[model samples]
Target chain A: MDTYYKPEHLSHFASIAEGNKALAEKFFSYYGAVFADGALSVREKALIALAVAHTVQCPYCIDAYSQECLKNGSDLEQMTEALHVAVAIRGGASLVHGVQMLEHVKKSSM
Target chain B: MGDVPLLPTWGPDVAGPGLPAASPRAVRSLRSRGSELASAETQIETVSRVDLSAMPYAGSFERALRENGWARLEPAPIEIFQINLGKLCNMSCRHCHVDAGPDRSDEVMDPATVEACLAAIDRCGAHTVDLTGGAPELNPSFRTLVDALVSRGKHVIDRCNLTILLTASHRDLPEWFAKRGVELVCSLPHNRRRNTDIQRGDGTFEKSITALRLLNAAGYGKGDPGRRLTLVTNPAGAFLPANQAAMEREWKESLEREHGVTFDRLLALNNMPISRYLEWLEETGNLKRYMELLVTSFNAGTIAGLMCRNTISVSWDGRIFDCDFNQMLELPAVASDGSGFHVWDFDPAVLAARPVVVGRHCFGCTAGAGSSCGGAIES
Candidate 1:
């Protein structure tokens, strides 16, 4: 079976720079700065990245951030809770759309 | 104490209840398993297999030192004389770089060797004596060695596996150590139970907590310099440890809030890739990446503080090494003539002038914040 996602690609992420080096460099530089310790700890940033990875359903991000989270000292319980935050948001996103449908039905009926 | 779980005498088969799915294999030394990695040569070969074509210093530890203007690592007057009593441990933690376990009982230091070590200590001028092993307390002469060191006016440290203090015979060790003013550097992989147990064995966390409570009752972890209780945490898995200061804060808050356990400080260490840990890295297919991580994360700032520069590690039988990791890999500290030196022949001046040994495993020490037996080298 042909697979779209390859585990090895995660390690080869730098290859994305091949097509446009300057832009990729800027993005990477910014990305590195973004994840660094600030008001939010590196561990906290990693946890946020983990939750976002799950929301975006990016396997590369998931793999990268899972290791990153662990490396930054986030435990399994914390990581699992971060994933649930993504799940809740993603679920709420779909459910909130029900309001639009409800408004449409009330206008169309009586 | 009655509610606390008792340590198993041997393997993972007798691990406590509610063991995580990832419980480690039966307690046995790599030597007994006849693993190729049991040989230090094979371990060195494995660590050297990583492709460092793109890495600075070409992933060569010695070359990295040279390139960074450290032509050699020479001892700064010995401050710590670390003794590896033996490998006779009750629990065979998966990430143990020593390959220590109950099966290693035969490897304990004999009385003659202990006497030789004391003689060396007298001449070495080290203010601190660090006793380490599968469990240093398990040694029959542990108290004898401690009393000897104390009488000589040396500060003694016990690199304790917290669970060992909960064992039946060793149960009173907390108070015993407190009485002697011995610093207890206990290993408790995490503040939480799950990660701690996963790396160690089942019920290890509970046993550790129970032991900590005992230590507390004995007046440890109470901000008393005389009763200092230091906790050492290595990453439970392949990753480098978090910032020591940061992790110490978090560990303090969490442990105190949740378990009502207090500790003086935390020492975050990087797990060296050797022995049983090296085996786990290979089996999990993380050997290559973990090695690369160590190489690329190398911080030159950590060179001066490298434990090998100031500490002399004496093996159970009196052989000497730059540090404990080197001792496990059988890399003896050599003399000017390139012959392996022994504790009995220890000459502080000669040892000080000798260049420290380097290998691929040295990268583990220099990685990230840099790790040592004491903790991260850099702030």
Candidate 2:
């Protein structure tokens, strides 16, 4: 229960890779590029990031991307819809594994 | 029950002693009866009224505008001159930004101030004159102002709370407004009855539906260019309004199928956290969350189209403000040197050069799609 997972740790995350500057620099540069506006708008990217934040269940990402969604002109209704998309996919992933159960049950019962 | 009026009503008694009939410049403040008296100095009028000095929000709105390339926010040529007739209303709604009610009789604008407004309009040369109040139609000089503006070839907008038309005295308002080519921007909070009644009062939905039908019968909202009827909706609770286009579709379908009522367009507005609405947010323990929501949801694109840039807001007592929200907060329009100005001194050149007076409550206008007197800005 006692760990280094302080809420303030998120702010100090970049410090973790200070000992490995070259790799950390490359990773941050790539992240900055990935979220930039391109074919998909900044709004679209924010919504996508919100959905992924829900799927991964990162508290920091969820907090940051929720504000991101609103800052980019998305409403509560649109944000709720994006979260539901992540929920459906996560639920579907679990349900698809039931195919293995069905195949095993049918073969063994026979 | 059949013969009874839907709501108790009273016409404006302009000859009454409570409202001063002096010229606009002489009437500094229209002090409400049995309420706190305001001093002549406009700046210190309401010292404790919603101070923005220690706002809990983490960011500064001015810094945000600057970072977004707005070195100095300034006004463009004034196109709309909005006049707040007064705060007299039949119904005491729960979420009124004006805090308007039947008890606010003394706050009504006198005929002298109305005349001053017309003179200011001629001087400003603004294309549109927007008349709003607790219910602007309640003003005794409402028709006189409208007729004068129409004769002068100025576009007029009457911000009507639909139920006002169902009252006994205002029954002929629909036909009169339609005849003068006055665009009716009626307020109906929701399509369903529960939300509308909860935010307004019991039977408000029924009366509003009746008023909408009457407008429809008068050729308004029937796709006529001359007779335009637009519905304005604000969220019932502490949240930014849904998208205007999406809500418009839903409102059209539900109103048509259920009540057979129709309107030309739906304007969704975000409820500014001020007056009665701010009290509600504080009571529900949502004031902090709501402030955070507005600050975090700020959109830089809304700056260019902010209504304060294109509109001149004149208060009931002839004091000028940047917007109606500022009027309620007692934040008078200030020059760069920080002196206040009155409506009688309205100069287009001076108005265009003056910087807008803003405070933390401005977050209400910049949040999401952005809100203004004309509903959402971006959409």
Error of 2 at B349 (Å): 1.7
Write one digit per residue (lDDT tens) for candidate 2, span A49-98. 99999898898888778776654445566788899999999999999999
Per-residue lDDT tens digits for candidate 2, residues B94-117, read 677787877677888899999989
Report the Cα lDDT for candidate 2: 0.79
- At residue A51, candidate 2 shows an lDDT of 96
Worst 10 residues of 1 chain B by lDDT: B18-27
Among residues 3 or more apart in sequence or in different chains, the pairs in candidate 2 whose N, CA or C atoms overlap within 3 Å are none
Interface RMSD of 2: 7.5
Give one digit per residue, the lDDT tens place, for model 1 in A7-85. Answer: 9888798999999999999999999999877888888899999999988899999988998888767778899999999
Error of 2 at B68 (Å): 1.6
Q: Fnat of candidate 2, please?
A: 0.00
On the 0 to 100 scale, the lDDT of residue B35 in model 1 is 84
Top candidate (TM-score): 1
Model 1 residue pairs with clashes = none
